[model samples]
Target: MSPLTTSSRRRILFVGEAVTLAHVVRPVVLARALDPARYEAVLACDGRYLKLFGELPFAWRPIETIPTVKFLDNLAKGRPVYTAETLRAYVRDDLALIEAVQPDLVVGDFRISLGVSARVAGVPYFTITNAYWGPYSQLPFPLPEHPMTKVFGVGVSQALFNLARPLVFALHTLPLNRVRREYGFPSLGTDLREIYTHADQVLYADIPGFIPTAPLPPHHCWLGPVLWSPEIKPPDWWDAVPEGRPIIYVALGSSGENERALPIILQGLADLPVTVIAATAGQPLGIKPPVNAYVADFLPGAEAAARAALVICNGGSLATQQALAAGAPVLGIASNMDQHLNMLCLERAGVGARLRVGPLTAKQVRKMTERLLGDAGCRQAAGRLRETLRDWDTGQVFAARIAIQGGDGQTTATQP
Candidate 1:
């Protein structure tokens, strides 16, 4: 077969932070989708998702990240997830990887250390992030789950949050700025968005209409949703899932809000006319689901989302994107800024409903679920968004950007 050779090849290393499956899986999807004949694809990531890596034919190696619990705790406390010590450790690991791969270009998903090491190694670096995190994003910054919200009600808390968000973003940027200065690179300024997005090229895994961003800079582009679902066998219950009633799919995912959300949601859906299909994402709900519900450790969320009438999740972009991709409206119980931002965009598009994680109740859940279930307008909006996304091939866009950054493959061919 001659290994399906190409005229010129570049070593493209994908560094994925493994605090959650999303970070790791996003890069894995891209690495596998690259034309291997034109690029030597390598995924250097922690094995938090070792189960999800089997079919990736590219080369791979281990890269450690902080414990997921610790990362979640930081988010819960409204503190920076990565500290100087952790990021310093990450830089050491990242440098070792860059040296090992000798990659022509490195693509990272939330792998912040690459901002320093990729430059030190003189390699081209690209970052994949959500559009809402970009400076040009127009989504309203709702008050995330913060202490301020508890102290002063939603209105006052939101007012204070709007005034203090820049400072908060600045505070989050300190660790990376300190690390960059220590390595002789210029500070990335006060905007944490710049710090988080420091790269030779920046790609947003979102659509312009759904998230509604201002005109992006030349280096930044919307790569659309780099969507991937776990390749797990559906459970026995999947085959016989009832088609007699409206289906509601519930998934909290691994977004640090699993304490009581699933149980509460299940309790709320107990007597509804709908049949609920739920996914725990490998977390156990300490309470049993109602007779009207079915549970799985993980499901092909995209498939289940398409089958259901409404998709309920922790309001992160991953699930909401899946739902929208399937033409299903969303019911989001959002906690952190990321989830809140995603839900806000859905609300703007009129395809979803949002409930605060802190103030959420089973009654609110039931009411919103009923409303979203019956709203033909919401379904129309989701279907419209689905049509917009139907033609976007994120993998193709990602590959084209790599070709541009690799100088149309000419530079790689000339390399010694």
Candidate 2:
């Protein structure tokens, strides 16, 4: 296809930091939502998930990211995911891409290097993140599934974590600040959230009721939850799952780390009268399945979430959002801070409960699963959120927000 004249179409480039599918899928959802006649879209990211996007119509490029296990291990070890070295490399790639694309706007999903690269390149920058991390948002520090949590127990671990969180945030902020300083940009202080979300525009893919923030600026707007699921053939066992019983769908998601949790979850639910549909997400679990359980390597999440009486996941927002969208409450077995934060909102909205993944037991899993199964209140709360999502066109909202900022690629804070 021939390039359109610059005057005829606005160019937008979406850069993803694909440590997992969520980061990559979020931006892909936005990019696919734009009107091709009005915008020229390009996606640049680590090449790992190119097929996951599955035949993109837009221009695509490969950019290296730190290995997935490296990123996951950092979360597991309670260390910062990015190092100064990593950020420096990212900045270099961001600059190279910006120069090549000459995009009118750059939208990034967790491509933190854009905190500096976009400003230096004179391109308008937009960062997609959860609203809970917004500076103005109200948040609670909860202990995640970790070695410390197991050692100290949930209550004491949370108390100590709440006290040390500021220092922890500061420690994580250093790599970004150090990278920014190296590139002649001043430090964004010590708050990692602030550093993460700093941009010409910050778009949150969450709804207001689920995560209300201190009044946001016009430049910062809610884009709702930009959700996606790959189209794939249903598993052969899919037809065998009886529709007569209450269905429970369990998927720990790609990032949830504890493959060991699968057998425990299956065993915990073994005695239940419900049919359990479980996705190992390509992880192999050695446990023999109960007659009531169906296991697959993957399943279309939205379908499973919609059909289930309840959803159990890693407590990350993507799966939680899908479940809530389907009016199904979730049982979040959270292992990291991100999952913990998502569960915090789910619990607040009265639609979900959080279980620390570190100390997770078959008995505890059974208890929470039973609670969600029997409680009408959880389904009621999920129904309310489901209704709210009905009016949300997340991709369209993201596109329109960027379009309104098109003239000079600058945003005005909701001025009357």
Candidate 3:
């Protein structure tokens, strides 16, 4: 165990890679939940989403991440996200922040640089990630909409992807492994799962039993979903949603393929009897909504999900978790691997359906929405999961996990 500061509080430094909003938002939600009295938390992240947050309870440090557009493009192309040079720079920044904070424990959300920096700094590191990314996971890997999928049809593309999947994942690990060697550490091998989970402790941000996996090691633990919604006011049309017709809530999130799919969703649901509520995750939709649809740049997501009969999204964990927490069935039009993996778990759980974004049609969206809205079994599954989610006290669970390292005292909040 690492030593606490003179103040006797366990200093925890949280680093989030702002490559996407979900990465930054997950850490912020967890950092806010810690008991300020028992733990001293300092958040180091890119300033892109800082304005979306309210006044933070703990200290804040500015850090740098690759541009979101570049990250997304690389993922879309199925290429290595970080170059060796980019990771080297990330190590420099991470070490500087670690030295400044002098934290006893480090918690990171998708900031892969810390796999090297935290070990170099001799601190206990815990990483927040999804269960599907774990080596123990039994989830199937579906071919994402990459170059191969376009050049060849999905049937042939999927076959090619399966044969090349191991090599592709190995390529993504090369940059991180190169940086580890620079830090005088052994290479983490060619397995991308090992690279993502190379920390002292691995914390999964998911519901237990949702994703099938082999028996986990003692160091790996489920932290549950770190749910968060923007604290913004609802649109002028929030209360006017009629009760006679079913309500459908659609959100593509910040990193979701929103620009391509939102317009089709609006047009497809236009002729239906239901009312449509959509949040653009702050992007300009450029397209007009149907008379039955109310589109906004942002909305308080939790309330919207609770009010909706069905939730349509990009099948990422953040939005899907929101819908599950509200007892709303999901209709995920997934584009990337992460979103596809998440939707697969939801499908197995019987609370949602998955549609490929590559061949998505407004007709398909309307058909799935109609099916989920009428599926009583799906609704019951969501409601049961919602009750389970409500019972998970994420803040308390987190505090308990790290308390043994230092600051082993009663967990109490000071309203940060």
Candidate 4:
């Protein structure tokens, strides 16, 4: 087939959650992978991610909408909370965005409501999630903390997770149902748990060690990690890192929980010997780094990871993966369900360690950092994972799959 004659472009819409840069970053990589002649991609996310997407060539539509809401009661009590009203608003806005875009295929990165909206609109929908979120997922191991919350000591966390799973599903569904009725869309009859299981394609971004899945649905695809690069230029100081010492990069994703946890992290890493480069990302914790630490509002994760000896973070998947790709071990202090789960996966893979935020102290941080730096095992394991990552072209692979599904025909295009 002639190249020009075989290339076909299809309009694609990406609905991302602006709660963190990871959500936006995943889609951006996928967009870059897409063939310009075979796909015209537009991103729908909040204004905060605009700068993150500014350097991309594709057109962007800012959707000043919330695709999910944390329950205030949950936040106040330091527990998982869900509200019907919040879900309703999220679904409503998501539906509106879908209607406005009306693309051939809709891609949702952890934005649950968008899948439902696409389904209702009779559009093909795809989503990326960890295997932990899969229907048959059972926690493979114990949580580092919260032993009391465990059920049988054999995956007790998993058991309790199973126990509360129904109620949590209801919490997500009630609001979506309310919005569906309000918007004149037919009720799905199923709850949120079942709703998540209904996507036209469900891509699990995690590797096998963390979440072991068997006999999954035909729509399920495990595409591994989708690595990303930020468009923002690194600060002038980035070029000046000391030549001999290994660098340690730290950044928390844009989440309220992360903002609250930053002080604890700053206090923990204060006396570490490694050269630390911290990306504040607009969250100020009122702590100054030592002369060895480089603080900036943002820097490209890919670049930082390439130069780092280790990475300290709130367990954002994209950041962690980038570090691992660069043969750097990670120390993760996570604050939310997804972040905690992502950290657990990394730990299970033997590439990182997780520290609980509650009862966190400088002593524990110092100990963890010392262990990671002093021992060569962590770095060796990270290097091995990096080799595996280097073997796969995740962005191009995922984009090719999408192009095939959308019937766009450019299966061999080189991804950016």
**Per-candidate TM-score against the hidden true structure:** 0.94, 0.95, 0.95, 0.83
Candidate number with the higher TM-score (1 or 4) = 1
How far is 205's C-alpha from truth in model 2 (Å)? 0.6
TM-score of decoy 1:
0.94
Q: With candidate 2 superimposed using the best TM-score fit, by how many Å does residue 405's alpha carbon deviate from the native?
A: 1.4
Clashes of each: 0, 0, 0, 1
Stretches off by above 4 angstroms in model 2 are 1-6, 412-416
- Cα lDDT of all candidates, in order? 0.84, 0.84, 0.86, 0.68
Model 1: per-residue lDDT, tens digit, 18-82?
88777887888898888877788999988878785566698889999888888877887879988
Candidate with best lDDT: 3
lDDT of 4 by residue, 118-177 (tens): 655666777877777677676543343343443354256557756765675566566556
Q: Where does candidate 4 stray beyond 4 Å? A: 1-8, 67-83, 86-92, 140-170, 177-193, 208-210, 256-260, 407-416
Output the lDDT of residue 181, model 4.
68
In candidate 3, the residue pairs with backbone N, CA or C atoms under 3 Å apart (3 or more residues apart, or in different chains) clash, namely none
Query: Residues 266-351, candidate 3, lDDT per residue (tens digit)?
Result: 88898899999999878778787899998888889999999999999999999999999999999998888999999999999999
Candidates in descending lDDT order: 3, 2, 1, 4
What is the per-residue lDDT of model 2 for residues 1-416, given as tens digits with 9 covering 90 to 100? Answer: 12223478878889999998788888888888888998889999888867655689899988888888898889888799999988888988899998988887789998998888887777778899999888878787676666786678788888898898899899999999988787777788988888878987889989876786789987788889877776667899887789998999999977875478888888999998899998887888788888899988888888998899999999998899999899999999888888988899988889999887777889998998889889998899899899898779897788678767765535632211
Give me the displacement of residue 49 in model 4, in angstroms: 1.3
Candidate 3 at 62: error in angstroms?
0.9
RMSD (Cα, Å) for all candidates, in order, is 3.5, 3.0, 4.0, 5.7
